[model samples]
Target chain A: MKDKDGVSGVDSSSSGVNRRDFLKVGATAAAVAGASSVGMAESATAASFNPKKFAGTTVKILLVDGERDQEGIKDKISYIQKTHGIKVEVTALALGAQLEKIQSVLHAPTSEYDIIDNLGFTVSGVVGGGLFTKLNDYIANKELTASTYNYPADFPAGQLDYTSRYDVAKNKFGGKDVYLIPGMHSGSVIMFYRKDLLAAAGIPVPKNWDDYIDAARKLNTGGVSGTTMIAANDVSLILVDWYARFASMGGKLMSGTPGAKNYKPNLNGATAVRAVQHMIDCAEVSPKGVGSFGFTESVDAFSRGDVALMLCWSTIAGSAFNPATSKVASKIGAVQIPGDANTSGRPIRGGWGLGIPKNLPQKRKDAAWMVMQYITSAEFDKYQFDKYQTDPNRRGTYVDAALNKKYPYLKVAGQAMENAKMLDVALIPECFELVGEAAREFNLAIIGSQTAKQACANAQASWEKILKRAGHLA
Target chain B: MLYSLGISFFEFDRVAGKWNFLGLGNYKEILSDKVFWSSILVTGVMVGVALIVEVVAGVSLAIFFGQKLKGSKFVRAILITPMILNPVVVGLMWRALLNPQWGLINWFIGLFGIDNPPIWLADPKWTLWTLIFVDIWQWTPFIFVVVFARYQALPMDVFESARVDGASPLKIIRYITLPLVSSAVVFAAIFRGIDSFRTFDLVYGLTFGGPGRSTTTLSFYSFENGFVYYRYGFASALSYIMVIMATIGFSVLLKWIPVRRNH
Candidate 1:
């Protein structure tokens, strides 16, 4: 699988971070796993760093499955034990089951996982509810975070706001209180387009919603459809598709604060209706029966070169650019989500957060922080991104010159993170309910069973009823 | 059951980690919930249609196989293969086959000069029927196996006497064979009905209860509220309601059928 650059997608050979070389000695050295052989040479330099401080202690972690979370960490567990002197055990679960597991453990009188990965969608609910221990004290301590680790500054500010800090008292986002740290991955949606098709048709890249629709219509020729999207009855439609369009159009999702008595969704507004209508129009140029597509179908369509354009998660669909698994790898180009005239396209922030449960013993919390710092270090961030193409949360890794040459999409995705916005409804615990209800209604609209107005209106009513039942509305 | 019964009396707030007593509030909420009622309607249509098709197809196959024709044993073995496959695998296989763009079902139909076949899994009008068809395809063999065993065990002397008495084939089957197979048929119907009523895995793998709740069943509804929404109390009440409904339905069925022998 050769790319346009004539480099094999599987080879990190020319770059100093050859996976085979790293795997050869990964069992003996910890810092080597984090820092590539050609980079800073941290394994020898950080020799004074004592990993055996808590040698006998074992820290249990719960990680979400998929996209290099468990794989990245599991590959380095032996190295971590050697360096940190703490044994690591990881239990990974599917997205839905992970949420249930977190809820069950946090509600129990005892703790099962010393450190847990918080699914980004549930961060506001779990963190706002005070399920995790505050990590500010640990971050401030040199021994826990290490001397060279830049602490919070290493991660993008937007990611920190979305995954780390939560205002427990106000039950809001963007407070100074840090409860979690960005782990294994952080990502947002970006657009992937067929450069060859757009070039052949003499069409420019779409910059706004109106331009996007026009381009799609013109591209819907020959055997290929213009574009594909995830509008199936899945939560991703709410996250990646609707929210990307709505927020970019400057639509405020909710009018009131979470947990406020007057809190209500702004679902039936003009912008909301227009966004749904735009999605319906996009449906016209998509492959037949795309109304039922989830991530699998939409990504498969783009990867198979059956579609000309796609807007999808960077972690999941970013691989379509790799020649190893995609037919259009050399022909595709990626960019930040398209913006409208009024606002920039802000793809809903998506990722996992690492945190220690509040009920854990202090010693365990300290040991857990050690492991967290090691896995999330800037060096490890670059390592995993180069090895497995896991989305990186650190600013330094995305901007690394060597990585950009291999994966050009990283720069745009990193820019996307700087301006990304968290899903507003996700701040509340009933997030899935709001998103789920709206997803179903809008799905009906996409399938031509209802008008955009009718779908938005139905969604508004369902939201109001749910809010009232939860005592968020009077 | 007792634990769910208790939870039904309380509202468990998963986010705040608190539980409050609601007494019969959960029940009252479910009674007026539009989604709950819609789910019941969907479940009724799906179960009713699937049960009728499965029973009829199963019995027809059973009687055909009971003739003991050549290679009947080999054909019977092949017939039950779908029943043995995991429901998840079946759903996935059909999901591929029913794909509107590239699926074999539409492709085969297209070869017959039919263009633009209905999207089997996406269109709201067709999704429910498609699911029912898949259910029948997968579970009909279970009924066939049960009724076929009973068909083979029946006394041969009765059929001999009926034939000697100059009864026509249709008359013999109506007066003697039908009566003998009545108990087995009733048992199979009740068994298949209960299983169909509780369908979840297939729906999860198939449409995920949508094109817009058109394929949602009571079990799927209960699952979404409990696991998806984390509304433990409300979901518990929904489950208990389904339990009561199933019990009442079976009680009526038993009363309607005369399982006792007249002799």
Candidate 2:
């Protein structure tokens, strides 16, 4: 697929990352990933780093399927075997089954996987419970690390805090201690719209929730619906769509302290009501049966030119910018989720992280680290992003000139990730239950079965019940 | 089985990796849980409605094809197609077909001059019935095949004597045919009843137990708690409650059917 970028999307010859740009990317990565001035400066030079240190060792990886993760790894397996001299085996399963598989693998007498990629939300339960090996010692060892391997700098700081680093003693997300590295992909919510349609309609790019609704109403044409969303009674309803609007509208999600069993939900607040009501308003302009639309349907409709706007994860919706998958491929534009006049859009951070199970033998764990380093490297981040559009983890990959030229959404997505907020409820093991209950109530409201206020009240009640039952609320 | 049953009495805190004994607390919470009771009603409605329709439709088809009419042999082979496909695949296929905007079903209905059609999988009023319809579409064939086999094996003299006695086709079916085939109907109903009681894959693939627990069967709820929520003890207790209900319900049904007199 040749575009104005003058490079083939699949051309292995043209790796978009130059060494000079990559070095610069490493230095400023932390700032781009959203944090105070940070660096991964250790005194090790290139002479100490060896790629083939673990020759002939086999390392197995487990990842959740359908995220375009396994395909890209399979493409590079031969290259890895030749360059790194290690055999890499990857197994990807559907999300629920993979979570169950991780449970069994972790508890097994001998761990089944050398490196396990976990869902970001489940990190609290797994890593917080001390089921993963901390990687601080391994990262500090020059012989085991690549000289240029930018530990937490190259990844988003919010993602690092959520998935990579954990304070086991305090049972909190962020600390200096490292346990995992963001791999496969990391993403945040961004809005996709039809540039041509908005321009033709003279509708300015929506900068706030009110503008968004007005634009959606104006764009609802003879053949096209105005907008779509993940309004289904699925977890994405809460995480992807609703949370973006809620946070951007200045709604605080939880209050009190998690450790004291006094966590309180803010679902019944004014901002929460407005956020849900905004979804209820958008449903009027959405496609028929939009209440049942999951991530697939909403994105598919936007790609097909049947819907004009969508708020979706950058990872799943990247296919919409590809010419092969999308009808409006050339006319699409991506931007951070819109905020009202007073605040900024802060979509919930969504992605996975790779870590070694605590039960694995040290030898296997060491071998797994070598493979893990390569998969999370800036070079491979560009390689996979260029080839498969698996959302790049490194800010350098998102900012690569050739990639930006090929896919215009990269710059906006890069900006979006730097500001993405973590779902506070995800720090608890009952997150799925909490998110699920809210999703059901919001879905009913979106479908006109209940009022937005009633939905919020019900959701608040349900979340409180669940939190109290789980001993996270008094 | 016993491992899950034992786990039912103990809550497994997944993060802490410990099983704390709850004894009857799990069962007590489950009984009081509104979602659990709603799921019970959903499952009850699904099994009751789906079984009756499947039995009636299955027996009618069995009686229709039992005559050995011409081309019935060819049609019979095609009749069981829905039952052959996996329930998940069937659910997905129906979901696509029921898609309100561009689905083939709605489009076909549009040809009749109706601009708007019911959102089959999304609407609370329609989702459960739509599920029951899909179940009947798939499992009615099971009842047909089972009853058809029984119909074929029945002695022809009894049917022939009834015909000679001037009984009409409908009368013969009601008086003689239904009585002899009552055994197969009971067995097929029980078999289909159990499968319908434990409906999970269909709900997972189709509606995912909502617009708000509208189609969440007991089995689907058990799966959501065990797998999605990681509430192992809660899910296990729910499953046991379903078991107790199924045992008592089927036992009463068995006595009510009077299958012994047919022999």
Top of the candidates by DockQ: 2
- Alpha carbon lDDT of residue B91, candidate 2? 79
With candidate 2 superimposed using the best TM-score fit, by how many Å does residue A125's alpha carbon deviate from the native?
Answer: 0.9
DockQ, every prediction:
0.64, 0.74
Question: TM-scores for chain A, candidates in order?
Answer: 0.88, 0.91
Segments of candidate 2 deviating more than 4 angstroms: A1-48, B261-263
lDDT of 1 by residue, A151-188 (tens): 56556677888888888888777789999888768988
lDDT, each prediction:
0.82, 0.85
Predicted candidate 2 versus true structure: per-residue lDDT over A1-474, tens digit per residue: 122432111111222333234346644763343321111112123547677778899999999987889887888899779767899999999888898888889878889999999989888888888899999999998788775676766776677898899998887899989998998899888898999999999987787899899999999997888999899998999999899899888889999877888899999999999999999999999999999999989988998989888999998899899989889999998877887655666678888899999998888999899888888877777778877777888877777677889998886677566667788898888888899999999999999999999999999999999899889998
Candidate 1 error regions (>4 Å): A1-49, A54-60, A66-68, A81-90, A361-367
Local accuracy of candidate 2 as per-residue lDDT tens digits, B1-263: 89889999999777778899988999999888898889988999999999999999999999999999999999999999999998778978998899887799999989999888889988999999998889899999999999999999999999889889899999998888899899899999999999999999999889999989999999999999988888888899899999999999999999887885634
